[model samples]
Target: MAHPATDDARLPRSGSALDVAEYFAPQRTSSEDLPEIEPLVKNLTIGVLEVLAGVREVDQLARWLGEDAYRALVTRSNLSARARSARGVAAVRPAHRILTQRLCEPTDGVVEAVVVVAGPARTRAVAMRFEGWDGRWRANSLALL
Candidate 1:
């Protein structure tokens, strides 16, 4: 009995175009080199989260935001008629353990999220935002939904 050659010639060349390298070329993609999922949320959340991971003071939270919104977000705890909402939640003197999430529109790179702040409450749903810098994906505004 003979075994199949199992080489490039044995396989369909067009389908195997990405076979140039063993590790990197696994598939031949027609789409752009980007993820299928929307990046609307994940990108911002990830950046803020990464910065927060290194944070030792309240001021650091303001740094993740755009210039105009920073002042509003840092002024004090005030979001709605709801008393002392997650407003300045990160600035609470002591941080809370809670879930943080980013809902995505990957292609647009905009997102919404529920950021876990303090005890019991656990999360805040941030929604309806855009992500872009010169038409490229960036978290333009992060809001609590």
Candidate 2:
């Protein structure tokens, strides 16, 4: 039997489109291009919970929120009542843990996360949207349900 030619046209050659180089090349993604955001979300969510529980003052969240959100939160007169209701049977400082977190990007520089928080006596879902501005994550919107 005769051996096949090493330069056979059927064989893939280096730098060809069929080469695996392109497939293995490093991929660029939005997440990679942007800064890390999940840890910010976690901390912000915890702070929001603390505010809702009245264990933390709304002013403490000011730095994390945008101007509009901060103003709205600060002016809301019912936070104390809501906090009392959420506290339920737990003490002044309830143990809260994140149960689930889902994240998505609605647009560039914006990340939204829906998180479930479980406390000693109650559980609630919190949705927070963050925008990357001035090289930091700022709360664009926050809602509790």
**What TM-scores do the predictions have?**
0.36, 0.65
Q: Judged by lDDT against the true structure, how good is candidate 1?
A: 0.40
lDDT of 1 by residue, 44-108 (tens): 44434333333332255453355544444443223221332334333232244435554544553
RMSD of each: 13.7, 15.4
What local lDDT does model 1 show for residue 13?
A: 60
81 Cα displacement, candidate 2 (Å): 5.1
Candidate whose TM-score is highest: 2
Task: Encode model 2's per-residue lDDT on 92-111: one tens digit a residue.
Answer: 66478999999998877788
Query: With candidate 1 superimposed using the best TM-score fit, by how many Å does residue 4's alpha carbon deviate from the native?
Result: 75
**Candidate 1, which ten residues in sequence have the lowest lDDT sum?**
76-85
